[model samples]
Target chain A: MKKNVFTTVTLLARSAGILLFFLYLGKGIQFISHLPIPGSIFGLLLLFLGLNLRLIPLDYVLPTGSFLLNYITLFFVPVGVGLLQYSDLLSTHWLTIVVSSVISTIATLISVGWLYQRFAK
Target chain B: MIYLYLIATILVFLVSRKLLIPIKSPLANPLLVSILFFIGLFSFTPLIYQDYATANLPFIWLLEPAVVALAIPLFSQIKQIKKQFRAIMISCCFGVVIAISTCLSTALLLTDDKILLLSLLPKSVTSPIAMAIANETGGLASLAAAVVIAVGLLGALGGFSLLNLCKITNPQAQGLAMGCSAHAIGTAKAIEVGNEQGAFSSLALVISGILTAVLAPLFAWLIGIIITI
Candidate 1:
């Protein structure tokens, strides 16, 4: 039991370290370049390239990735809770909020889905 | 104090997940339920949103690395993904355009506040990028973050059924729609649906984010034209 637990910790630390390194590299590049894009995005691209190049073995990060994906929903709770900060603004402008969020998301979903479904032709 | 807030957030989330499972509806989404739990929980406690936000700072920081980890899913699905790359890119482009236009026109129907309009411009993308875009375009970052989360929640809840209603049988189509329209929350839901969906959604989230960043100014300008008329 101790051996298995220790192995899990080691794997998590190593994988997190590698992911954080990429994340920082992305931040550095974005800082220097004055890019409009988010650093996390740059980090994501770099990591994808690294994997494609075989520089980082897939097994090295797969467990961490799966774990993150599994619980990504939980991570959004805090930010979602940040909704409290704007309750006043939201309530007054409820109409605009409804129209924008509801209509926009539905339209985008339908259009993108419809467009791509036809793309195979 | 901090531990109290952290413990509350985690406990609320875990319990919400467990309780929401048997019900099995997106409206009862665990994230939505937990957020509501905190929002309600706040009214009873001496704490405020800022306190909870501060305690949960680490989770926000984890978002970027989580995004980086998305490369794993992308890598896993790369072979099949490459075959449909162009189609996915084209669909994402259209999705971004649709998201912006619909949001702007609909919001314009009710009000023309520049800051609010600018903030809503990036509502369809992930919160981090949405906030950045909102700030760069003379919008309130805080408002942008709020709107982004709202949009993500809305999509995460209704995106699947709506896609099905539209007869979008293709996983790639469904995933791309989720990513571009819903961003991170949608991607999270897509991951729950299946790996292929998750991979494609991540790809579209990144692509749509980049597109929105590059075109944010144009949308901002469009808002100017929109309100002036």
Candidate 2:
């Protein structure tokens, strides 16, 4: 029992450590580029490229990456709760908001899908 | 007391996810359920929102790195993605253009509020990028966050049904559309559909995010020019 607990702790620590390393690497590059893009997205690109280039071994991130992905939605729960802060505005303009979002979402979905389907064919 | 707040957030998420297995309805989305729980806690209980927010710092901090971790699945499908790179790129660019234009026009049809317009402009992008675009375009970042989620939820709920209606059988097409229109939430939904869909969705997500971040500012500038004229 004690050994299993220690192993789980070690795994969690290793996962966070590697991911944080990549995150900072991405932030560093973004800083140098002076682009307005978020560092996390930059980190994603860096990790992808690093894997393709074989600079970062797949095994290093895979175990932790999959572990992280399983809880991906959990990470966003806190941020989504922040939406409550705008409940007042959301209530007042609910009509405009819903109408626009629905129309916009459907329009983009159709346009993008149709265009891609045609292009692929 | 602080422990109760933290435990409540985690407990709600776990129970909500368990409930989702039986419900299978997107409206009962785990994230939505979690958010609603906090809303109820704040409204009915003596528990304060600010304290709850403070307790959630650990989860919030994980968000960025979690995004970074998306590279794993993305890398897993690189071979297939590379085979059709040009088509995917073109589709993503086209999607970006359509997303911004339609969202802006639809919102304009309803209201002429600049902040609302700008907030909805990046509604198709992910949260972090959307917030940045909203801030740059003179919109309320907080409102943009909510607008982005609203749009995401809509796509997640109806994206597959809508794709079927459009006769888009191609997983690539469906994935790209969902990612381009709905961002992360939609991508999550796509991932559940298939691996190919997940990869393409994430690819489209990255490309569309970059495109929107670049083009949204230009769009705002163009709108400003037209508004002044």
Candidate 3:
């Protein structure tokens, strides 16, 4: 029971820390520039640098980070559901989406792959 | 009242996971299945998109933390990434440029609207990052997210065939291709191929995402200049 309680507390604390960091960057980005990239992306870079530079303890964020990553898909469900709102846009642009995604995806794969093989040697 | 949406999402996802266990195909991704399930559920039920949004606000907020949490895998892979740092960086840069430019040029030809261009700008990245970028660029975040999902599904399902058709057999190349193009779903497919492929794909996923996040705004600016000219 003691161990379980400790685990729960740790999870909560770590998760709160991660959330706080994200919010921090979100607000900071708002102040800095109205850039299109989300603050979360900057927050990720910050956390990554912090860990790499040993500014933040790995254990402090590891559990919460892994947990959130594991369920990242769940978090996007709302966005997917937002698809309901764009039925018209989707229908009108379905052909473009299908053809473009396919062409662009293959184009990306070939270009990246060719470059890696060309330069890796 | 709002909790109902959460409960239903979890249940549907679990059911979808169980059903896909035997099929073992990338096309049967739990994310796609769950999203479709929820879309169906909302259609039949009295709940509307706004109702779902208001109720599922917490999950939507979770997207921010989820993006931040991406640092963990990236950090863990730092040592390995450092070993091939130059190669990885070069390939990622090339991939991002190719991916964004192709999408942009294609979309530009297909549509005269700027919002659609914004929506497709971030389609190469993961969904959360894509949605965030889309929203910031004055596009519909929902449209971006949906497009990202479809892109992921398409990559997961068709990636291998494309690779084979191109005669690209190098694991690193294959992984980078998938991760750069498909994002997470393609990473999943790469993991199935081999550990080396998985590692490279994960690295590509992170690098491509970061590169897109950093470079997309600049690309938008350049495109704006060109348009005005």
Candidate 4:
């Protein structure tokens, strides 16, 4: 019974944290969507500010946060699978996708690796 | 119908996770496997993306909050992050600029499709930020999301293997390279490698995401692509 209660409370706390985070994100999006900048970026900034201000305790939120991070790719599945709708665009521009992704990723690896070697001492 | 699809997705994920343990190769990633399963399913069935999206919308709504929750980890590492602020900022600026410009130049030289050009701009960033950039830039968010997943898979599958092949032993270097190039999935792999690598990679992911988000638009504007909105 004790273990059950503990698990329930932990689960409740995590769900609450997730809920609050989304509410905050929605408000941030609404505010920044009007501006020239992107709302999600502003939402991230707001999250950063909120954290630095100690408005949200990291310990209480870490479980939910890590949970989300662990399965971040799962969240992208819908959007990714949605690509089927643009099959024609993809087929026509397959080379562009191939070149851009392959080149950019390789470039990123090289540059970041070099910088890390030079400065991360 | 949509409920059945969601159930199928869950089942596929579980099955893939089990199958992956025995194989334990990069190709066995549950995400990639589940996607392939759906791709095959859609190919044979008449199920449209619209129907799948309608079913998947609830799950999709979770992404924004998950991203917001990334602040917790960032907040916990605040002091370490503060001490290395200069290094982080400088590296991020250099990293973001090189990533975007190289991608843009490569895409432009390789193809003239405006939509393809915009889609590739946010490829280095995390998915949510990349999706926003793609949407704002008049590229298909769905396509950008696919590109983001592909980038992540590539980073996870090849990153550690290549690191071993190249004999790059430094945890910091490994973490930063993974996060900078591969984003969250790379960071996940970094964590599996070691603690220090994971911490640094997570830090790099946040900083790199922010930098890419800010720079991609400016780069687009500077290149004379008039903002459609």
Q: Give per-residue lDDT, candidate 1, residue B130.
A: 89
Candidate 4 to truth, TM: 0.81
Runs with alpha carbons beyond 4 Å of true place in candidate 1:
A1-5
Best model number under lDDT: 1
* Candidate 4 C-alpha lDDT tens digits along A3-111: 9999878875875565465556656665755433334445555766766887755565666667766666676566556667767766877788878778887777767
Candidate 1 chain B — worst ten consecutive residues by lDDT sum? B43-52
- Displacement of residue A57 (Cα, Å) in model 3 is 2.6
Provide TM-scores for the models.
0.95, 0.91, 0.81, 0.81
Answer with 1 or 2, whichever has the higher TM-score.
1
lDDT of 1 by residue, A7-105 (tens): 999998888888989999999999998877788889999999999999999888876777777888888898788888888888877788888889899
lDDT tens readout by residue for model 1, B164-220: 877897888888999999999999999989888888899999999999999999989
DockQ value for model 2: 0.70
Which candidate achieves the best TM-score against the true structure?
A: 1
Off by over 4 Å in 3: B44-46, B108-115, B126-146, B156-175, B183-229
Clash counts for the predictions, in order: 0, 0, 0, 0
> Which pairs clash in the backbone of model 4?
none
lDDT of 1 at B171: 87
Candidate 3 lDDT tens digits, A41-85: 667778878888998878888676667666666665676677787
Candidate 2 Cα outliers beyond 4 Å, as residue runs: A1-12
Going through the candidates in order, what is chain B's TM-score? 0.94, 0.88, 0.74, 0.78
